[model samples]
Target chain A: MMSKFITLLPEELHASLQNKYNEGFIYLLDITAVDYSEYPQAKEEAYALVYIIRHKSFQEHILIKTYLHTLEIETVTDIFKGANWLEREVYDQYGITFLHHPNLRRILNHHQFVGHPLRKSYPITKGQLSYEVDDLIDEMNNRLLSKNVVCRLESGSFSECNKDLMFLNLGPSHPASHGTIRTYVALDGETVEAAVSEIGYLHRGFEKSCENHSYNQIVPYTDRLNYCSAISNNIAYVKTVEEMLGITLPLRAQAIRVMLLELSRIEDHVVCLAAVLVDMGGLTNYWYMYNPREDIYELLSKLTGARLTNSYMRVGGMTNDLYEGFEEDLKDVIKKVQYGVEETLSLIKHNRIFHDRTQNVGVINAQDALNASMTGPNLRASGVPFDMRKDTPYYGYENYTFDVIVGSVGDVYDRVMVRFGEIQESIKIIEQVMQNLPEGEVNIKDAAITLPHKEAVYNTIEGVMNHFKLTYEGVKVPAGEYYSSLEATNGELGFFIVSDGSGIPYKVKVKAPSFTAMSAYPDIIEGSQLADAILTLGSLNIIAGEMDR
Target chain B: MEINTQTLPLETAITTRLDDAIGWARESSLWPMIFGTACCAIEFMSAAASKYDISRFGAEVVRFSPRQADLLIVAGTITYKQAPILKQIYDQMSEPKWVISMGACACSGGFYDNYSTMQGIDEIIPVDLYVGGCPPRPEALLDALLSLQKDLRTHTYNPDRHKDFKGLLDDV
Candidate 1:
């Protein structure tokens, strides 16, 4: 079996993971904990610590299940640096303590937050009385003021150097950080001595909401995660649920999904690269990029009703077929995007200022990036040619011809360039898919899985009864757990679902790419200038929606 | 080329109160803070972009600093952790400011009525207008701004006026 459950003493975790690390499970994909207190079948353990790891060379992945009957479990941060925030997140949600974890505190919810909301026992509507706004600000300011760092002078005398290191809060509502991400940087003049990012400013408790919502009802919520590429998020989520149900999509549906995924990829990259340039004082490029993005949105609006939140994907297939004239509209959008990409390249490719601002700044070495469990373009830029699309070809990604773009000396410039290349590759993929469009039904005809047609529902008794059951109770997925991932616009967008043979998912854990990418921000910006820090953050493309959720 | 304004009667002149002039000036150039938290932020950007062109309504100058802005367009979902930060930003903005809660999330938490999201931004700060959509379209956001402009023109600066305007605060 690819996955195995091993019960080990709390102290044996470090040694066991060390053995696994040597065995080529070098990359840690995710570390999450699930509470099984309410489940009568799980009498041996109250919480399950789930660890997903991947081999560096073979691309083989394994799920390591370790059940914890006690509150405390060994911290894997020593073995994998990326486990720092992952452990904290698991702790924050499941209230399971990770022993010896560095800075093990709340990662998503506030430090003042009450009961772990991910626990089944926690009330969904239970609200906490947060500190007064003014008081919170005052307290934060006081804490910043009180933070003292001693620096040794040239004469070898230690002196209080807090005055030299100015602590600047760069977000929560800043133009440069894009969304509601706050990076507290201790600046030595313009150079950053240290940096720490505080997220959860956009945490809507998506997991908790998922537990309460039915299978299909959770589609809209998926749109909000990685809103730039809503279709990709939608497809990633539904694909996971579909996998658990062991459903196979039609060839046409798969082709359409690939098309949309590439389109979403182009959209995400355009926004990210444009926003990066804008942060570096290239306002003209924002217009150049967004103009095409607006056209894509128009096409998307025609395909689905909404422009931004296109919840287009269903469990078995898609919610609706491509609208009439969709091909022509899509062609027009592709042309526009191509024009925009060319124009953007001309404007910034040779610009000396752009190079000076981005090149060699916020460099994350390949080893550090791997240790941080970075994925997608960010990891690829660090000289790691690990694209999930290439590694584990899903949704017939193997049928498509594309290059896995990689860059050496990972920096802001390399990251931006990687995205630029990915955009071009996505356009190529989209054009290829359009040229060889498949013909068949978009959704599966299985009455038990997909909803019945309206005509059949109105005319036939069995159809009416089937539609009612599907609509009211939703699809009853067999009791099983599955982790499905896709090459999301940002990176490996994964959804880990635990089903209990019910219409509602027992546990829904979103392994958001931006979440992991954002965790490495402090490390990336440690020694860079304040302006370059902004540029690096922009290139990271850490969407607060995806990160916090 | 100077006209004989001294010869005209006081009533014949373009007579207006200082408050009316202030209201007109404030209404014309309402600088909104760029405070977008989620998907609605994208639509908000589109409104400010070349297509919808929010500059036509004199709200073109999108200020990143709260101290400089006069309007707070809360453009997406505001969570519990962000509520205090939003309140702080609102407090920082100069007085006689207006807020346009753009999108269903900011208006009433939209589909995410969970432990993290605030039920509505109005629970923390007073809102002058609420644009409705999971993420309202750019045109809806523009309409909200126009309506906010109308409110700014007619409404008095007195703090007590907000109490009478409570009916407008109903869920969109």
Candidate 2:
């Protein structure tokens, strides 16, 4: 039954929250934001007006939205500890400072990071710093700046900390940080006191760049966001545009998209699983996992032409039909994948060393996970059966019968098991798609949105002109706002597009799963030993591409 | 004494026998450090798997700690942020070590040209052999192994040419 309640609170408490918490109570889903660029007053008001959502059922959602003006926006941090990073992120990206935020240094960018990168007015070409190795040599030779030019960059009373607490900068160089993300971890002896993730080291202002490029051009940039699973990103972005345009993909096209997505998921998970094993010092598992992944890539290359950055999905449909020998090759690869998975499980999953390293490490409880807005395997490991595919039933996943795997103890070992179970489920999905392969047009005949056939483009005059125009000047969508979220190999990969009925998106905000998952580190690592932090990080599998983006 | 030099085929035979024994020792036990930096690093892992089975060549153990390794497979894109660390790891490895630069990015920074990437790993460290392709297939990496094995047969440590690329010769 649906329950509704209306209560009048004391004006003083309501006013304080409205000013401090932006809107005090988050009612609906976990969290959401509304762009106020249209209102001139929004720029000065210091509040972006956020909605906190609590989901009850499929279509039932409750929203709690309030407006708080400044850093006077006091920390709800006490109520939701996970908000520590999210508030910091909202501040870092939008320049919306939250009051009582303990440490609000730039999370995404470097210390020398010039400006707030996510502001709508931020220029794409201007204010970007370029560094080349050759340039470094030239600078050294010029003598305008000495090798050890001791500029007093920071001269302030910043030394107010416990003698027991030591600050450790873990990355922007370390192998395990994967990309350019650095963590400023404050440690009390061997246990972590507090840790903050620093991002924007690889920030290229992609969102701003999207405004300049056409919808088609934006696909290539999105590929670099989560380079490990480029296909999933491609699918998410296209799906958002499709929702806005109000177009339905053909049956064959849907199957093809699912096929490619599952393959990408397999490859992405294999690499991450391999990384964890490699970090734990059992190097052989890394070897066994990647062989089948390579075979999958071979299929990808044959089907999409490029392996990693395959911009295969078009707006209305896919770029091309499936290649002739794809099914036969896919069947062969599946056999190899089965063999590889078995070998990996036997070699490492049950091994004593593997268990000792991963078990009881980086534990997160169910309530804490929900409060933090955790999704994907990280949340699923904590006993939340919230798979986007199963929970929301997207992309024909409802047709296939698969279990939503969960672990009792939300630790590193559980995350591994959840992923392992998902891989088996993914294999089953691919097998079903192959068994029930349909016969029809792989791409739609929406000439306005999709490019013409190659034969028509080469042979006919109108087709030639249409092809050129579509390639350079992409088709525009009707003015509307749409959000699409998919269960990526990592987590909930979402795209929120704001269109102005132009070829370019007015504002495109990507809610990357890694960025959210990494935000919860401070909460997860609160009482754990320092060495356990690395183990916990590997379990989360936060790809810097997505996190920094 | 000059007339006697024309008569001995036995002396040449013994020299050839000694050379084969030395080559066998050099070919076996190539310990490669796990220097995987990107996607090609994934393929390097595959080369060590059961199906590809790199154990036949006696090079299966991908040492995590660099001090014990003799071969450095420079896999994936070598970014500017990553270059110095790569150099330090290369320096830490024992003497008589060789570098097999794997993939197009490691050979020459694949597609990223604007900034952030180093263009080529050879610009930073001396590469023994360069494997080409966006990310060369695992089988292609196996080919790199055979080529690195050939390099071990002829090249030896020389202090004079340590920093001098001008004096180096193509073994092929």
Candidate 3:
């Protein structure tokens, strides 16, 4: 077993990485940008800090460092191939350049985009569309604000002069391309020679929105990131903040977090598997798998007030105790979903179309899979025995026993099989948690951060004041940086947050596994037919919100 | 299987100019372009499935290419980057087309307060009807379709309709 390293660093450490750090292997987890206008002179410089984690043996952990300047850093793509997309993301969100990186164009936005929308300096509200020719003239003369960047058209498509390659934009609107994100593929007919994924067609800059709101106020925003599994997002954010505050949730709260995360895993995998089935031309299986998924959503909604972005987990604990009759409702939902899962498995597990479509298509050998930095089902499909929940337990995951499912053939079918196996495993995990339900306070009794009882607030004036202050101003996290990762529905969802001991976080950066998995799309689509391309894309289950964030 | 007399007679020929117009309309039972942008797109998927069964109204075949489609179902949020693509799709579609701006985000940007999201998709393209709800239920999406069909039956194919609807949200 490799020792997990969690090193906290000051600004001087940034210079050390630039000058002397040469690794056995280095992986840039994610970068978080912070506004420093209000901080003291020592910390008053706007910076983007990235967590560089090293992977070894069965366990993987990382060290942290903060960078003061947005100067172009040496591309880590040459070192740890996984850093390619992470560096591009830093460029996209913070306008920080990463030198010596190939294909450094915008990954999330259009090429001719004006501003880095994720930066705090950018205005939050939408501006009026200025059509006056005179306004353009004034801007050209440097007499007025630049209106061109607000609502502008980006020109230039791929050139036809290059006979060797052609560019195809895959579905900002196309059926196979789920939602609004598009992948610009440079191809020689069916073979994708190279690819650039253009995201931010759905970029809402969720990180920037978190700055204006308080800690508790930002749970809804996390919901939109990976809307397929909002519970995972909630867990990541709350856990990271919990680390910063040194707040330990009660036993019941930890168990509830585990239960919710497992259910979310089941739902996320079901939809992904069903969608992949449809992509492979097995519609009957798609509909069959989806029926049980509907039941899961119903169960989720009954437990929490909202279904998708449950906001169930709070900083210290949950929004409220589980809704009454949740146990009975959950049991029925579990029973029906189990039946639905078996029916779905039988429908497509032996089907000819599914086998033919997925077996040999988009094969990624284990070495290439590691090189491309694939994770979750995709990496497991390539026969990598890695699962965050099993390997590195968080939020009571280690207490439950389950297999870390792996596959031999790293194709679409193997990925499906991994998710299918994991869904059964998730059910096993949830079942255990339900039966061995821990008896304790649902939330920490600390009233300073969380609100006191409604009765207490109504009767006592201090309780009322505590509630108001916590709601409006939010809880102040201690000044420090904390890194935490949870086994999200997709893969490892990590949060690297830097707190300035303020109500609002200095920076909260999300490490979305789907986004990293999406970086390999161009590689997966190479030499495949157009329809196969759709199958691989859907099978990957790349979420645009997470990708573009 | 015996055919019901209540079912309309099947016509094989679509040769004449008049027949082409009527036949296209019959085919146009309004083919909805899958404009699924986010979570609401899930409900849109359920609507197209066997249970809700959108094929009952003869509008189930979703065309991947916009050139073949006449109906655009705006299923979720229209972000700033997504706005241009949505407009381009609407522009590529044939005339006498209808758009169902489904869900709150497509209608008015929903809970999004960021600069990246467009307030309403109608600012970029014309919408025939708006379906409300976080994700409007399948029944709501079906209602939008019925409403669009009603409007389509009343109005003939008009070239001027495109120009009138272009950049439509001036006063509203």
Ranked by TM-score, top first: 1, 3, 2
Measured with C-alpha atoms, the lDDT of residue A392 in candidate 1 is: 89
TM-score of each predicted structure versus truth = 0.93, 0.75, 0.85
lDDT tens digits by residue: candidate 2, A125-182: 4442222211122222221122122222367323323336566766644557665555
Regions more than 4 Å wrong, model 3 = A1-26, A32-35, A58-60, A66-70, A126-167, A186-189, A457-460, B1-28, B56-58, B149-172
Compare candidates 1 and 2 on lDDT and give the better one.
1
Worst 10 contiguous positions by lDDT, candidate 2 chain B: B163-172
Candidate 1 collision pairs: none
Query: Best candidate per DockQ, number?
Result: 1
Which has the better lDDT: candidate 1, or candidate 3? 1
Residue A448 alpha-carbon offset, candidate 3, angstroms: 2.4
* Interface RMSD (Cα, Å) for model 1: 4.0
On lDDT, the leading prediction is 1
Cα lDDT of model 2 by residue, B10-70, tens digit: 5564334455555557677788876765556555656776667787787887775679888
Each model's TM-score for chain A is 0.94, 0.84, 0.87
Per-candidate DockQ values are 0.47, 0.11, 0.30
Q: What is the docking quality class of candidate 2?
A: incorrect
lDDT, candidate 1, B1-172, per-residue tens: 1248889886775658787778788878888897899998988888877888899999999999999998899989988888777877887987777888988888898888788888888887888788999899999988888887776678767655456442212332
| lDDT, residue B151, model 1 | 69
